[model samples]
Target: MARRGQYAKGAAKRAEILAVALDVVAELGTRKASNREIAARVGLTQPGLMHYFSTREELFLEVLRARDERDHERFHSPQRGFQSFLDVIAHNASVPGLVRLYVEYSAEATLEGHPARAFFEERFVWVRALMTEAVRHDQAVELMGPDVDIPYVVDLVIAAADGLQVQWLLDPSIDMADRLARLWQGVRETSWPAVAT
Candidate 1:
C-alpha cells in the first residue's frame, strides 16, 4: 500500500484531472472529448492519463460522480420539500452541459453491462428515499396533508423532476423551476383544505 502522503498526492492529482476533464468535456461535447486532449490540458501523456483511469468510460463515469458530489454539497440542506427542490432545479439551469451529461448517461446506463449502471441505480434509489423523507417532513410541518399518499407524492415529484430535465434539454425556453413551483402550489391546494376564518 502507498504511504499516506503518496495516497493524498494521488487523490489530489485525480481531482485535478477530473476538474480539467469536466471543463474540456463541457467545451467539446462528450462525444468529441478525447483522453489525449484531457491529458494534454492536464500536462500528461495519453498513457499517463490511462494510469489514473483504465478506460475512457471509467473516466467519464468519474466525471459524473464528481459532478454529483459537487451538486450534493452545493444544494443539499436540512430543509426538504417542494421549495427546496425548486432551488435545486433553478441551480441546475446554470449548468446545462453537466445536465446534458447526466441525462445522457442515465439513459445509456439502462443498457446491460454499462459502466454507469450501478451509479444510476443507486442515485435513483437514494433520490426516492430522499423524496419520501421530504414528503414526511412536509406532513409533519402541516405543509402537506397527512392524508396524502406519501409514496405516490414522492414518485410524482421524482418523475416530474426527471421529466422536466429532459424537456428543458429539448427546449431551452422551458422554465422548469417555475413549472415545478406551480405544480407544487396545485398539489398543496388540492391535497389540503384551505383554512377558514
Candidate 2:
C-alpha cells in the first residue's frame, strides 16, 4: 500500500511538471525552452527534475504528448468527417506553440536512433489510417462520390494539412484554416462526378 501511494504521488508530480513545461514552451518556444526553466517553475532543481525525467528530450516528449491528448479531446468528434478535421485545424491555428512542438519533433524524430522516432512514426501511421477510414466512411454514405480514389484523396488531404502547418508557422498571415477549408470544398465539389452503374 505504501509503495502504491509513493508511485501515485510521483505520477501526480510528473503531471504537474508537464503542465508547467507546456506553459513554458508556449511562452519561450521549443528552441528556447529548457529543463532548468521548467524545473524552476515546478519548484525543483535541475537534478531533482532529472530524477523524474532522465533527459530534456524525455521531458519535452512528455509535454508534447500531453498537448496531443488535450488537442485530441478538443477536436475528436463522434460524427467525424472532413468538416470535423477542418474544425480541428482551425483550433490548431490558435495554439501555435502546440503546432510548433509537433512540427519540431516530427522533423527531429526522422533521424535514425532518435528517442522520439518511434512515437512520431506511430502517430503518422495512425493519423493517415484514421483519415483514410474517414474518407471511406464518407464514400459509403454517399457523402463523397463513389468514383473517388480513397488512397489518393486521403494522402492529398493529409499532405496539404501537414504542409500548410509549416507554412502557417513561417507566416501567421497565411490563414491555415481558410486554405484547408477551401481545399476540402474543392475536393467535395469535384469529387461528386456522376458514376454510371
Candidate 3:
C-alpha cells in the first residue's frame, strides 16, 4: 500500500512503467528485456524505471497482474457475450508475441520457488472458478444447455483455451481462433436438448 501523498501520482507512474514493460516484453521477449532497455524504450532513465519498479521482479509481477486485470475487465464488461470470448481469443492471437511471453512465463512459473508460483496458482484458481460461474449464469438464462455438466464443461473450456494458446504460441500458422470457435460450437450444440417425440 502507498502512503497518502504517494497515492495518485506514484501509483499512476508505476502503472505507466508497467505498461511500458508490457511493450518491452512483447517487443524483446521476456528473457532479453532488461531494465535499461525498458527505460530507454519508455523514455525513462534507468533510475526512473527503478523508482516505479524497484526490481525486475516487480516489473514481471506487474505483467502477471496485467493478465488478471485484462480478464477481469473482459468478464465485467456490460457488453460481454459469446462474441466477447471470441474477441478475447482473436485479440490475444493478434498480439502473438505477447501470447508467446505468457506461454513461456506460465511454463516456468510451475517450477519450485518460482517468483510467480503463487501468482499463477491463484490466477488459475480464479479463472477456472470464474469460468464455472459463467457457465452457471449462461445456463440459467437458457443460453447454455442444462443437460451439460457445468463445472466439468467449464474446466474443459478453460483448459482447451490455455492449451490452444500454447500451441498457437509455438506455431502462429495454426488457426487457433477458428479452432476455439469450432470447439465452442460443438459444445453449444451438445447443450441443445433432443427434440420431443
Candidate 4:
C-alpha cells in the first residue's frame, strides 16, 4: 500500500537523521550539539529535519532510541545471553555520548507529562526485566548463589552501572569499562569462590 511505503520511507529518513546526529554529538559533544547544526550536517534544512522530529527534544530523544536499538542489535541479537549484557556495557563505555545523552534525556523525561516520559518509563521496565531474567538464570545455573537476594542484587548491579555511567560522563578518567568488569568479577568471585581464583 502507498501508506505503508510512506511509513517505511519516513522511518528510513528518521534513521538517517539519527545516524548523522550521532556523529555530530560524537564530534561536538552533547552539550554543544545543536539541532540546526545537526540538520546542516545531515544536508537537511531545519524545517526538513522537523518533518521527521517535530521538536529538538523529540529528535534527540529519538536519537537515544536509535542508540538503544543499535545496542539491541549489536548486544542482544538472535543469540543473546548474560555475557552479551556484560559485553554491551563494556562496549557502551567507549561511547561516552551514548551513556551521557541517555542519562540526561532520562532526567528530563522524569518531569510529568514530558514527551520522553513514556519512552523512558517503558525502557526502565524492559531493562529491569532483562536484568531479572539474566540474574535468575545465572543463579539457577550455579553461576551465582541460589540463596542470593535476586531482586535486590540485580537492582544493586543496575544502580551501580548507571551510577558509574554518570560518574564516567562527568570524568572520563574513571575507566567505566574497567569498573564494570571489576564489578562483574567481584560478584562472580564472591558467589563462586572455588573457580574465581
Candidate 5:
C-alpha cells in the first residue's frame, strides 16, 4: 500500500516536470533550454530532476513523447481522416522550437545505440499506421480514388511531412501544411495504375 502511494507521487512529479519542460522547450528551443533552467522552473535541483529521468536524452525523449500524446489527442480522429493530419501539420508551424527539437533529436536518434533510436522506430511504425488508416478512410468516402496505392501514399505522405519540417525550419515561408495539402490533393486526384510489365 505504501509503495503504491509513493509510485503515484512519483508519477505526478514526473508529469509536472514534463509539463514544465515542454513549455521551456517551446519557448527556448532545445539548444537554449538547459537542464538547469528546466529544473529551476520545476522547483527541483538539477540532481533532483535527474532522479526522475535516467539521462538528459531520456528527458528530451519524454518531452517529445508528451508532445505526441497531446497532438494525437487534439488532431487525431478516425472520422476526420487526412484532415486531422493536415491540422496537426499546420499547428506545428506555430511551434518552431519544438520543430527544431524534433528535427535535431530525430537526426541524432538515427545513430546506432542511441537511446532515442527505439523511440523513433516505434514512432515511425505508429505514425505510418495512423496515416494509412487515414488514407483508407479518405478512399472509402471517395475523397481519394480506389486506385490510390495505400502503402505508397502513406510512405510518401510521411516523407513529405518530415521533409517539409526540415525545409520549413530553414525557411519559414515554406508553409508546410499548405504544401502537404496540395500534395495530398494531387495524390487524391490521380489514379495510380501499374505501368509497363
Candidate 6:
C-alpha cells in the first residue's frame, strides 16, 4: 500500500511538471524556456526535475504532448469535420510560442534515434487518421464530393498545414489559418481523379 501511494505521488508530480513546462514553453517559446527556468518555476532544482523525466528532450517532448492533449480537448471533434482543424489552426495563431516549439522539435525529431522520433511518427499517423475521418465525414454530408481522393486530400492538407506553420513563423503577417481554409475550400470544391488500385 505504501509503495502504491508513492507511485501515485510520483505520477502526480510528473504531471505537475509537465503542466508547468507547457505553460513555460507557451509563454517563453522553446528557445527561451530553458530547463533551469522550468525547474525553478516548478520549485525543483534542475537535477531534481531531471528525476521526473529521463532526459531534457523527453521533458520538452512531454510539454508538446500536453499541449496536444489540451488542443484535442478544446478543438477536435470527429463530427465537426474540417472545421475542427481550422479551429485548431486559428487557435495556434494565438500561441505562436507553442507553434515555434512544435516546428523546431518536429524538425529535430526527423533525425534517426532522436528521442522524439517515435512520438512524432505516431503523432503523424494519428493526425492522418483524424484528418481522413474528417474528410470522409464531410463527404458523407456533401460538404466534399464523393469523387475526392481521400488519401491525396489527407496528405495535401497535412502538408499545407505544416508548411504554413513554418511560413507563419517567418512572417507573422501571413494568415496561416485563412490560407489553409482557402486551400481546404479549393480541395473540396474541385473534382479529384479517382486513384488506381
TM-scores for the candidates: 0.86, 0.88, 0.81, 0.83, 0.94, 0.93
Please report the candidate that would top lDDT against the real structure.
5
Residue 143 error, candidate 3, Å: 3.9
* Deviation (Å) of 171 in candidate 4: 2.1
Model 3 misplacement above 4 A:
1-3, 74-79, 192-197
- Residue 33 accuracy (lDDT) in model 6: 84
Clashing pairs in 2: none
| lDDT to native, each model | 0.81, 0.82, 0.74, 0.77, 0.90, 0.88
Distance (Å) between predicted and true CA of 186, model 5? 0.2
Ranking by TM-score: 5, 6, 2, 1, 4, 3
**Cα lDDT of model 1 overall?**
0.81
Off by over 4 Å in 1: 193-197
TM-score of 3: 0.81
**Runs off by more than 4 Å, candidate 4:** 1-3, 77-81, 189-197
Q: On TM-score, who's better, 4 or 5?
A: 5
Clashes of each: 0, 0, 0, 0, 0, 0
Tens digit per residue, CA lDDT, model 5, 105-128? 999999999888999999999999
- What is the C-alpha lDDT profile of model 4 across 1-197, one tens digit per residue? 99999999888888888998876765676877887898888788888988888877877787787777887787873234367677777877677676778788888888999988999889878887887777667776777776666677677777888898888777877876677667766776676535444
Distance from true location, Cα of 182 in model 1, Å: 1.7
Identify the leading candidate in terms of TM-score.
5
Please give the distance, in angstroms, between residue 94's alpha carbon in candidate 3 and its true position after superposition. 2.1
Q: Rate residue 105 of model 4 by lDDT.
A: 82
Which of the two candidates, 4 or 6, achieves a greater lDDT against the reference? 6
lDDT per residue for candidate 2 within 13-77, as digits (tens), equals: 99999989888887777777787788889999999999999987898898888876776777766
* Model 5 CA deviation exceeding 4 Å by range: 192-197
